[model samples]
Target: MMQQLFTNAKVFTGTGEDDFVSAFRIRDGVFDWVGDAADIDGQDAVDLGGRTVLPGLIDSHTHPALMAGTAAAAECFPPAVTSVDELVDVMRAHAATVTAEDAWILGRGFDDTKFPERRMPTAADLDRVSTDRPVLVWRCDAHSAVCNSKALEVAGITAATPDPVGARFERHSDGSPNGVLTEIAAVGDVAAFIPAPSRDEQIDALIALGDELASRGIVAVCDLLSSRLADPLTTFRAAAERGLRLRVALYPGWDPEQPLADLDDDDREGRIRIAGVKVVLDGAYSNRTAWVHEPYPDSCDHGLRLVADEDVRAAADWARRNGVQLAVHAMGDQALDRVVELFADEEPWLTGIPSVRIEHATIVSDEYVRRLRDARMSFGIATHTVFFFAEYDGYEKALRAEQVPDAYPIARLYAGVEALALSSDRPATAWSGADDVMLSVEAAVRRRTYNGIDFGPAAAITAAQALMLYTGRARMLSPLENVGEITAGFDASFAVLERDVFTVPAEEISEVRVAETWIRGERVFAR
Candidate 1:
């Protein structure tokens, strides 16, 4: 490796607003000096042409394995497929290339809320794509899916088939299946029958996904649901050996009946490692399945609670015994309250980071924030702004008039909690560029949806503060050291930007692009 000095550039170390440096020195993949350009005048330095530089970003919560699996699927996301007719056309085009009569034709990222018809695509709509083969399209949330009639038959779902414990199959007037499967249980029934790709194909997909992430300036990520891939720990390790770009922390989904296999000694420390276990306590607010205290508008039904208290306790116990973090998916207030109550008396992790993380603390009240801080247990939250930015129509129907101001209160949480991160649950989100760090940052700064609806302007934070949610503030989400900063002894990883994000107009923050991305002091991507 070469020792290099980068000079004549604006660098934000991510510590605070005043933490800027004109130059930095990287020696053997770590920062050795980050100070004035005058101090290193004698040494040969690479001039940066006054470009703005930021620490390489960290996406605290994402689903890389799931994204990789669907890389080949037809993208039915908004702006491209805004109606049921458009969705069918995209799937049909994808189906045309597949010659196999028995192969499943797959599509993803269809949001009914954005459709002009305001309705989910039914089996009949998908039947136009193919009747001889299976056809399935996932709603953007990924919690539910709609399949063609042939797929329903393949999954053994019929008029007489009983709904699973926590899932449902939408039916028509005569009790025949409508081809809409709601929640994980119902989605899994059809998903299980879809043939698994070859191990080599899985590895290839992961590597390709890593490259895509690198190009977006993300150097690290926490795959919240690693179990989406078969034996994720081993598979990710193989991808790393084959030169995957990002450093990943895996959190395999926790199951009561089948616990994850014990981690190998080599799996404890490396480019890829198991960070913890994840257990989803409730569904998402977008689909009105978030288990909220109040029922949705004009409906008596509150959303579903997917797991039992005992099951959550079992997962907590597993994390405690193994000395790892336990990330709970609690999107609604009621579900968030349950987590606080259950762990109120527990002690903090000896490592001093959060022992328990509440994923998507979406509708947090001041009382909940106070309780989380005052509790004996150390708590962290991973939330998002993109949910509102991209899925505003869904929220419009789900939240009450009074509850609107409190949803994903970014500014409040930033002040109230020490361990808070704003992350994009990509591929699961409704937008095409859901993983774009700049897009999420812009949403946090502007506090406006894609259609220019302001949730609450007072809840917005500054551009720099929003960036911290993906940088220094986000470091606590993973155990990887020397990350999320440009300080001395930290990893020599950062992204050079075309323009300064801090000085740009509030709405133009998302327009800033990475000119170059470097990992471990080696330039991996350049535009």
Candidate 2:
């Protein structure tokens, strides 16, 4: 690689110091130096013409392949399926294009609450689409999956097929399955036919999604991979070996394709460290499956548990012993408690390691927040602050009337000892770049949604603090120390900005583009 120098640009290292520098040079992909142009005059130079520059924004969490994996087809009714009639119309349209050999007709993004009286679709709805072919649609949560009569039969799910622990098989009072599957294990029958793509294709699709992040100024991602998504590390490892412009830290999931439980996080050759093992404790809040401590005001139960206590402890221990950390996805208070209790256990090897990540710290409690700090738990919050936008996309009244908050609790965690850090949980939720940065810290401080609800204002933190969570404290969510900051000795990873966030209006932060982004002194993203 050739040396490169950038000159005449204003810079913000995201450190407390808002130092504007004159030049930067990179040799062999590391920051050789940064300062007066005269210091490196003999080195090759490219003037930036006084543009803004900052370290590349690092995405603490996301699922790259699965975000772009849904096969594109007809109009997806999604949050629009207001009635059985509407779903029927959309299904019929999707079925019209393919032959029986194409096998299943898939429907994604249906929000059950959007329907009149908030009812979910059943196997009967599939009759309107196609009787000979299988049809399966996913709820917006991606936790519960709905199948038609054909799909149900293919799974051999007669009334006799028993539902397993941690999985829900919604059935009729008459004892027949209603064609809904919840938790990853419940959907196994359908996933068998998902048709595996070659590793290269997986890499291409994942890389394509990364480009979307790059356009938004995200230069690196904590790529969360699952059994359904398979061994993305191999593909990403290959890309890094070839010197791709992006950086990724791979985390494994529990699924068929990802039998990584036996493997270690050692990755000197992959160019990507094994971020950790990802575990799920419950389902999405949208589907009402999150294992909450209190019942949703109108509901009778605490919802679901994606994994049992024993399983979580086992996984966390494995992560603790190995070099990798544990990144648990626990939204409900009960789930969070289980994680904290297990994490706080006095295990010799577990001490001194960074707090294991609790992805989507949605719907937390005051007790949970304190416990998290006492136990030293860390989190990668889905701070797109999107929940308040569009009135949480029209589910507000139904959700608020119940008054039991869903999604992770930013305020409590922020007010508690832990505070907050940022993560996009992408494709899992519709993602936004600036909104993520703003929401992580701003939402924590404001606690009011864009829609004007003081959801939990008491938990909000100041703007300056939020920036630290995303930039300075965020790297700790990984292996710790050398990531997400802009100190001189810390790798020159920073984002150049039109305005220093401390001085910019919080409302306008989301709209500001990165003037330039650098990693290890190399220009990874420049606008």
> lDDT per prediction?
0.87, 0.60
List candidate 1 segments past 4 Å from native. Answer: none
Which whole-number lDDT from 0 to 100 does residue 48 have in model 1? 99
lDDT of 1 by residue, 1-527 (tens): 66999999999887774678989999999998899988887789999999999998899999988876666678888767899999998998999887765678999999999999998889999999989899999999888999999999999999999997678898999999999999888998888888777667888988888778878889999999989887888888888888887889889898887986666556667778888899988888888899889888999878989889999998888788777789999988889989998997898764757889899988988888899889999899899999999999999989998887789999999999878888889888999988889999999999999999998778899888888888888886667667788999998999999999988998898998999999989898898
Report the lDDT tens digits of candidate 2 across residue range 352-414. Answer: 335477777665656655565665344334343444432254335324433435344554554
Which predicted model would earn the best TM-score?
1
TM-score, cand. 1: 0.98
For candidate 2, the 10 contiguous residues with the lowest summed lDDT are 430-439
Q: Find the 10 residues in a row with the least total lDDT in model 1.
A: 260-269
